[model samples]
Target: MAYESSVPYRAGTEGYTSFRIPAVVRARSGHLLAFAEGRVSSAADSGTIDLVLKRSADAGRTWGPLQVVARNGTGTAGNPAPVVLDSGRVLLLQVRNAADATEDRIRRGHVPPADGRRIWLQHSDDDGASWSPPREITGQAKLPHWRWYATGPGHALQLRHGPYAGRLLVPANHSTPPTDPQDSGAEPRYNGGHALLSDDDGATWRIGYTDSDSDTDTGRSVAPNETTAAELPDGSVYLNARNEAAAAWQRVDAVSTDGGEHLVRPFRPQAGLSGPAVQGSALHLGDRGALLFSGPAHPSARALMTLRTSRDGGLTWRTAHTVGGLPAAYSDLVRLDRDTVGLLYETGDFSAYSTITFRRIPVEEPT
Candidate 1:
């Protein structure tokens, strides 16, 4: 059977010219919330982008209008990482930047601290109805000397097993200088992956131990940026990352047992899973005895929005079905119920930047 998708957001609609970087979460009360960055003018990726959202109460069969959740005026505000707590509260963690600012300048120490891609958070007590003002959490969520950083860009996780039950975990990536400098720009040489947690159900957050190796690996996509995570039945975090872009367009996976505080090993490339240096998503549909991953299954291109399954807790993976054969990139997955999941991803005809889309896939056993 062919997988069907809905174009809830178009490239030029709702006053925004482009929509990108999708993230979705199924709230505790059964409301479905889909999020993306609404680029105001051109799709340059770093200017006048606001975090926007759409709500669906009918399990994605229908959706409401768009609502600007986090807007920093003309500045850039994006990377929607949302997670729903057991008590029905929705916590969103995002990144902020200055208007027209770029990542190169920030990494070279050419940007000011005020708009240097820091962390901010917003929450809603009544499902997706309302959101609080964007509160800066840079001090708590970020560490000293870190330059480029990003959260899940997908649904964060809440531990349901082990001693850290109810712990809210956000899989994230960051970068700093290597042990030795080779450039005059003082550029960041290594990328690191870690998890941020909130013990009080999203009230406050703290950075974890910063993965393995204080001075870890690096790549174009980097070793750990734009990664997704799932909690294994043993209470360990199974992390899947976009390993390297320009060179090896493949994916990597690792495990962390300390409630996402650290990884057991550096993320090693998985042989079967293929990508085009794009972000993907992972959902541990543990009850159904399946581990699901979403991304462009094409070996060297960002087309074919495909979903793969790993029945043996991510030790292996196989393509089950594909969403489409269009230009697709950067996706996030949400668990709708025991037998279904949702995908919010960037896809279009001209390019992947046309608009962020949503797809509903019925959970099935691994092929």
Candidate 2:
């Protein structure tokens, strides 16, 4: 059977104007939260991307109005992913650009002070109605670094059995020390991705394995983008990371036996949905035995047309099934119980019609 979907949430600027690029999650209180990088213009202003958040309480059946989590004057404020702390508290994770604080100093090139890349947290004690003050958890204040963003189309899962058993796992890309200019070519250059584990719920954090400087094998420098982790029954971690090598990004799976202390080198010709310069998601669903990979199945994959599923732990994949008729990319999937799976994707065309939308499907259905 094909995957079924519904558009429970969508946001437009002034008059149905699309400003989309989002991340989704299922809160502990059974509410659905979809967050996106609300852009004022079509292109990257790098200074004005805000975190636009919306919620659904009725299991993706309907949604609430759009709410602003954070905003930068002209810089970006995004990487909207949600993590339900062990204490049952829901934390919204995001990165905000400190525009006014760094614009002039960075422009003057006076050693280019790192643009503010602070990690912020918004806590919802009573569901999504109201939130606590956004706190900067990245303690790189003294450093000249400007950004500490985590653009996780991937959801954060808590470590179950280990020394750091209670810590939250978050995957992110480093925006500091922007690519080396001396080495330039047709290749793509950017900061690598890493993980941050929080012990005191959302109060504090300690970072985990960061990516290597570069990978010549993949033809470009290697770095992690959206990385999702699942704890096996034996407690070993299965990490599926979005690898950006060359210009295109592909999903690669790695296994960590020592509780994420280290991961084996990921296998190649990676087994999930990917395309040239595109993003995909790999989620552990249905009692830890099933995996849901959602993205463009073809290299030319565009829109929200393709989604694939693998039941036996990424060893093989069935043919892709379309979730929505729209151009879908940057999606998140999580099992909403046993049989239900919740999804949120950007809907619309290349130039316009952007919206962070929500949909759902069953676990036993065919891909």
Candidate 3:
């Protein structure tokens, strides 16, 4: 099969002025769900953004109309991180903030009650048809010191091995040192990443693991932000994170064996895989038992959307193909079948945020 593309979101349409942060997932019901941040005001990250979705029942040839699954009015309700249980139920984890609080205010520790950046969740028992109202889980999922926090801008995962086989892992990120004691006049940098574990199928949540500043000592800082995850055969959870530390923000990888509470080893940079400080995703292709990562490959730019494969469970990766030389940014990978995969991302000719799109890729090895 060839790679076919579709535009599901665009600037100035359907009451939304722009859209960004695309995430896709295939439910057990054999339906494709595409999600994006419907920025109702402008292309900026902050504003009245909602978690919007579209469903594709016929593989990838077509998609349903736009539906607002989660919204917070003028407030922020975005970064859709969805996971499908083995029971065919889809659970979504997302972040929310007050209408007046911008990213800057939250990262600086100037937070407000019931209005600060917090975590919320919703579930759809009927595939992608209807969603339950969002319920906050910030008390259990978020720490008191964490300010700028967000769930997977991509997708969550389901453990397939060990005692945590049925657990749901929500890849997430947050900034640390909620206070700037030194009075440094700079933007608050996201320090690391963590995973929220749901053992009872999205009922209760807890922090699995937190990436620390130990890796940042490598010449420059290394903040693991906007993470992606996959499970290995040995029951280890692998995280591919966006290093938003310096100009050359390379990607990093880590693994956890104990339900994401502790790391087997500190994060190591995936020097070969590169991209701008942006979100990406990872998917475990069944049958072949290989891992696939999707994101921009350019060092200083966010174009040249690249697809990579790892046979050894994320230890190393090789470029399988470049989706295109088009302007692309954030992307998420989803398995359509044993041999068919899908990529939902932001792509356009001039700007990456101009459109949120979808594409189907051949998942088998390239000859």
Candidate 4:
């Protein structure tokens, strides 16, 4: 199937040097919201960054002017994880840190508690026009021992079935202090995946299934980072994450039967899916019993943006279509309508950070 693509946030435009970490969600009113991290000076991950967004009224054919959702002055505000509530309210979860505090410093526990990574929540009632002030939720969402924190950087999940219906689940990752006091916490083995659960809309949040176990004796472990979530037909939660440590595959996955409170299936390397160690997105096609995943197809490089379909609840996958063959990085999926799906991803000619583009694809084509 052919895809119709357009660049909504391009590098060296709109007073920003680069844009990365693309996330998208379809508002309750049928508006498509696309978000990205607008880097001020350079394409570096750290430094001054702002969470910006754009709205599309008619699918993704065109986008409105850019809107600054949240800015931290000289600090960094990114990792947008947006979800639309049943009441037509949009809640976004993001992480903030000081401009000078890089991931390395935070992972090594060199940054002070006040300067370390923190989580915040914001809401919008009038679609994507305006947003409320960000409320700090680090105390409730993050553990003190965990460092190097990040939200989904994509669309969050809201359970629509089972006893836990209406519950909000945010896929997150964090690095813990090394078990060996002498060892550095910056090691990839310390990275793990978790979920943030909120029962009452965005009023409160609690930590869910913490997957930080690593066996040093056998050198076998699952260190999941940059995670994504999808709901299966049986009302179970499925999580797919990027493996931070050396593993047989680039992705790891787990399943939760009781909403997002606990994981029934532990984190393990996922087979039949190949990609670079990068953030990916997952979407369940309503009651179709089909799950869709989006990420780069290359195993060693962040290129060849591709989409895969899984019929057996993410147990196996088959390549459905390649969105683009150019340099691509992170991506997110949103159901635009009953027959169409929208994708917001990082792709460009020279580098993946050059532009955050949106593509519209037929939902039936992937099934």
Best by lDDT: 4
Using lDDT as the measure, what is the rank order of every candidate, best first?
Answer: 4, 3, 1, 2
lDDT of 1 by residue, 1-367 (tens): 6455677688899999889888888888899899988999988779899999999888777789999999888899988889888888899999999996687777676777787888999999988899998888899998878877888788898899999889999988877655565663775546677788989987788997464223334423436667798988888888888764334637778888888777687677787787777789998887777888999988888999999988888898888777889999988888877767888888888798887888788877544
RMSD of 2: 4.2
Q: lDDT score of model 2?
A: 0.60
Estimate, for each residue in 1-367, the C-alpha lDDT of model 4 and write its tens digit.
6779888998999999999999999998889999999999999898999999999998899999999999988989999999999889999999999999999888888889888899999999999899999999999999998888999979998899888899999999998878777786445358878999999998999998888655566454568899999988778998999988764678989999998888986788896778889999999997566799999998789999999999988999998778878999999999987888888999989788888999998876432
Error of 1 at 349 (Å): 2.3
RMSD of each: 2.3, 4.2, 2.0, 1.5
Give the per-residue lDDT of model 2 (tens digit) for 194-279. Answer: 66766667667766656633444555445555666666655666666666554444655566666555555542345444553455
In angstroms, give how far residue 264 of model 2 lies from its true place: 2.9
Would you give me the overall lDDT of model 4? 0.89
Clash counts for all predictions:
0, 17, 2, 0
Error of 3 at 159 (Å): 0.6
Pairwise lDDT winner, candidates 2 and 4:
4
Colliding residue pairs in candidate 3: 208-260, 208-261
Ten residues in sequence with the least summed lDDT for candidate 4 = 212-221
RMSD of 1: 2.3
Q: Which runs in model 4 stand beyond 4 Å of their true positions? A: 184-189, 213-219, 365-367
Q: Score residue 21 of candidate 4 by CA lDDT.
A: 95
Reference-based TM-score of each model: 0.94, 0.81, 0.94, 0.97
Q: How many times do residue backbones clash in model 2?
A: 17
